[model samples]
Structure formats: C-alpha cells, structure tokens
Target: MKLTILGSQSPYNTTGHNCPGFFIQDNQTRLMLDCGSGSHSLLNYPNDLQNLSIILTHLHRDHYNDIYNLQYSSFVFHNQKRIEKPINIFLPSTPAKIYEDILSEQNSFAKYQIIDENSSFKIGNMNISFCPTDHPVETYSIKVQNGNRTIVYTSDSSFSAKNRLVEFAKGADLLICESSLLKEHGFPEINSHLTSEQAGIIAKEAGVKGLILNHFWPEEPVQKYVDEAKKVFQNVIPAIEGLTINIPSIEKELDERS
Candidate 1:
C-alpha cells in the first residue's frame, strides 16, 4: 500500500497545510482517510473517485468539511449518475447516527451505511478494523492489512488513553500518527491534541516499522516536534507536504527464474 498526506495542518493552519486528509492506495483500489475541508476538489488524478472509498475518523468540521463536496462531485463528474449504491463508512455507532442526521439534509448520503466499531470488514483486497481512540468526538483509529503489509492511522487524539492504539497498531508496517504539538508545553486542554513525545512512545511500544507524524500546529516549531519524536523513535518522520510512502512487499519471481 502507498500513503500520501492530502492535508496535515492543524486547525490553526500554522503551515497552511490542510486539516487531516490522507490518501491510501493499494493495487487498483484507493481510499481517502479523513477527507478534511477542501480535499475532494484537490484530487485531480484520472479516475480518482471512480473506485474510491472514504474512511472518516470523526465528524469534526476540520476532519469532515469536504464530505459534501465528495458526494456532489461524484454526481456532477459522472454526468449526474446517481448512486443507488451505498458508501461504506467505518465509524462509532453513536456519531454514525449524528452523521446520518447531518447527511440526511441532502439526498446524496441517503444510502450510506456505518460499520460499527471492533468489526472487521473488507474493501477490495484489504481487511480493515477500527478501534476507539481518546478524542473529543467519536473517533476511531484504523488498521489495514493487504498484500503482505499492514498500516495503521491514528487521527486527532489525546495522550490520556493509549491502550486501544497499542492494540490496533501492534506490528503495523507503518503508523501514521498525529503529533499536533511539542512536549515542552503540556496539552491538558478540553479539546486536547497529542505531542511528539506521546507519539514516539506509542509507536515504539506498538513496534511499528515506521512512525510518521502529521496534523502539526502551524506556528509550532517544526524542529522541536521532530527532535522530540526522534528522542523516542529512531524511525520517526515529521510529515511534509507531498510526501509519499510505499509499504514494501515481495515482487513475484518469473517462471524463467526456475
């Protein structure tokens, strides 16, 4: 599987990156995880959404403002071709109800279904599962497995509860985590966010192949964050715009190799 940060800036827009969108592709299948505000219009690849799916972390505006755009674009770009087919959305049962109420405002989202937490499901050739995370909203961390590799994503969450994270990300090939701040200042606010130190510890304990941090605060010192994460994780990466990662897999041998 391949990963790209569609957007990674915090709500503060410190570096002008988008809020929380990330793109994942494996073989011929594609999924946009947490399509933050204004991301759908940014997808210009050929047949981008023809076989695309969306996995939302929560309903916070910063994380979901682009959903309506995704729904509208599908209809408009396909010459108003309607989707009597439902979209698969993995989310918590409660917020899933709220999502239904919100999307019901428009006819476009009438058919979508929400996959409850702890349930395993398949998308194309991938097997995926969701687990609760420590976030203000009904948030979920995703784990995906396919083609001999597993990757996990932990969207905006606090450091208070991390057991679920360790369970979900255990032995993942990559862990895409949100390190929204540096550790110098304790983040004990109402809508708290994680720090680089916390992310480092999480990844190290989970024993993932790599740890990539994202959703950085705009004005936050980038070096401070990177340096802090590096202290705990040797393979730590501070997310940069346009960065891409390909999870490794073995190439098939030709019959001639015999």
Candidate 2:
C-alpha cells in the first residue's frame, strides 16, 4: 500500500502547499482521500482522475473545497477520454446542504455515496470502515484494511479522555492523525482539534507501527511538532506535500521469514 501527501496544511494553507488531501493506492486500486483546497491544481496525474474513488471525511471547507474543481476537471477529462464511468464518492450526509448540491447536479463526474452509522464498504481489494469522530460537524475517522496492512486516518478529531478514537485505530500499520493544535498553545477540546501531544498519545495507545502527523498549522516549527509527538510515540513523522509512504505487505514478511 502507498500513501501520498497531496496537501497537509490546516484550515487554510499559510504555506504554498495545498490543504489536507491524500492519494492512496495499492496494486490495483487508487483512492483519493479528502479533496481539500488546491488539490485539483496539485494533482500529479490528470488521467488518474478518470477512474478513482474519493472519500470526504466531512463537509468542512478546508476538507472539501476542491470538489468543485474536481467536478469540472473530471468532466473535461471525461469528454477527452470518453470515460463513461463516474467517480465514486463516499461522504457523510448530515451536512445535508453540501451533499444536496453535489447530488442535485446532473453530472457524470461523481457518484455520491452516503456514509453513516457504522458503514462498511469495499473498493477493490480494500475494506473500509468508518467511526464517528468528535468534530463539530459530522466527521468520520476512516480505517482501511488490505491483507495484513491496516491504515487508520483520524480526519479531524479532538482530544477524548475515553480513548474511543484510540480503539478505532488499534493495531494500524500507519495512523494518519490530524495535529492541528500545538501543545504549548493548549487548545480547547470543544474545537475538535488534536494537540501534538494528544496525537502522540493516541498513536501510542493505538499501537500503530508508524505515525504521520498532519493537518497542522503551517507557521509552527515542524520540529516542535515532531518533538512533542515523540515524547509518546517514537516512530513519528511530520507530513509534507509530496511525501510518499509505502507499507510493506504480509507476503514480503513471510518471504523473508522463509
């Protein structure tokens, strides 16, 4: 499995990098996770847009802003490529206004699929499950499992004392968590954002093999975030645009063992 960071900045990018968007692919399947600001412009392969599945964690502007661009781009690409199949999009329903506009339009660009209440779905070889997050709006933390590799992405969530989010990410090979708050600043839990320390705690409790901290404030020192997270979880990385990560497959491990 491969994970590419298309954008990692938060709310709005202070840096040149786009907002929170990711491109994840395995051998046969390609999935776009969160089409945020500048994602359409930052797309490395316009042809890949022809056939892809997109999952939007919530309707937050920073998270879904690029959908409009994608719609236009896909439509144009479809005309050029004669692509008849619409892209599959999975998103929450409660921000009814957003989905209404997306689904109301008669376009061949996207097919909207509603994800709610313990929804589990399959796209090619990947099995996806959702857990309700502690965000202000309806948000979901996604878990994807393929073979022995598991990835848990906490789209946007606040600190929870109960540790339900930790349980959701249990045993993941990679935990892609949002670290929107600085430990020095002391964020409000009600705001639905995680501090670097909180992110580390979750990664540690979840027992993930690797931790990628993203959705961060662009102006802050990257090393500060890493240092804070490392206090709890050792294998931590700060996400930057164009960063590519590869998850080793179970077959490789078995081959080495033999």
Q: How much lDDT does each candidate structure score? A: 0.71, 0.80
Least accurate 10 contiguous residues by lDDT in model 1? 249-258
Clashing pairs in 2: none
Q: RMSD of each candidate?
A: 5.6, 3.8
Model 1 misplacement above 4 A: 12-16, 80-88, 96-98, 105-111, 189-191, 249-258
Tell me model 2's lDDT, rounded to 2 decimals.
Answer: 0.80
The runs of at least 3 residues in candidate 2 whose Cα sits more than 4 Å from the true structure, single-residue gaps closed, are: 106-108, 249-258
Cα lDDT of model 1 by residue, 99-211, tens digit: 86655645343235565576687888889888777777778888889867888899878877677788789988888898887766765632357888888888999998788
- Looking at model 2, residue 176 earns an lDDT score of 87
In candidate 2, position 207 carries an lDDT of 87
What is the alpha-carbon lDDT for the whole of candidate 1?
Answer: 0.71
**lDDT of each residue in 1-258, candidate 2, tens digit only:** 787888888778654688888888877577888988876565655656755889999999899988887777677778787556777888898788988887776654778889985799888889999888887899988898988889888989878632888989999988889988876886665467888888999989898888888887777887888889889887888877886777775334323321
TM-score of each: 0.85, 0.91
Predicted model with the maximum TM-score: 2
User: Which candidate number has the best lDDT?
Assistant: 2
